[model samples]
Target: MTEAELQQLIFDGLRKIAPESDPASLRPDQKIRETLDIDSFDFLNFLIALDERLRVEIPEADYGKLNTLDGMVRYLLAKLPK
Candidate 1:
């Protein structure tokens, strides 16, 4: 998928984790936890949802590096097929 498409997927999945969040309005650089209030469970759900969509397993240890939307996008980009 394209970067923008990946970004949208992450946004959509995260928005679902925090139903009240306005993912569309969030800036690309915004931190998912601080800005979107995504707790540990929500983060795990996000990882699971993304993994399902991308058909890859995102290790739990790597999840710590994805504390922000941008970070997550970067991580996905690295994991996704080039």
Candidate 2:
């Protein structure tokens, strides 16, 4: 899938998991933890859900790389099927 498609999916998933999230205002450059007030458990759940949906296993070490929305998109794009 294209980067935009991946991003859109991520946004949709986030909104599905986090009903309070304002998907429209989610900026790619923004820090997800800070901007979304996401705790460790929520972050882990996000990754796990994404992995299950995409059928890709994200490395645990790569969690730090997903601090921002753009970073998450890049990581997912690299791991997910095109």
Candidate 3:
């Protein structure tokens, strides 16, 4: 998928997991969990949701790399089929 699509998917997943989160105020470089006040459980669910929608398995080991919007986008971009 394209970068724009990935970003949109991420935002949509965030909304599902954290309806109070304001995606419009999200900074790409900022830490998503801390910035959005997302707890561990919610974060995991968000990741799972992303995997379900994108059909890409993000291993637990790589969870740390997806702390920011840019990070998730970059990581997913590499894993997604061209």
* Ranking of all predicted structures according to TM-score, beginning with the best and ending with the worst: 3, 2, 1
**lDDT digits (tens) for residues 1-82 of candidate 2:** 8988888878877776678978658787888778877778877888888888889888888888888879988888888766
lDDT for 81 in candidate 2 is 63
| Tens digit per residue, CA lDDT, model 1, 1-82 | 8989998887789778998988877776777687887777877777788888999777777867787677778888888888
Which lDDT values do the candidates have, in the order given? 0.81, 0.80, 0.90
- Between which residue pairs do clashes occur in model 1? none
Clashes of each: 0, 1, 0
Number of residue pairs clashing in candidate 2, backbone atoms closer than 3 angstroms, sequence gap of 3 or more or interchain: 1
The Cα error of candidate 1 at residue 71, in Å, is 1.3
lDDT of model 3 at residue 65? Answer: 94
Best by TM-score: 3
Local error of candidate 2 at 81, Å?
3.1
Candidate 1 yields a Cα-based lDDT of 0.81
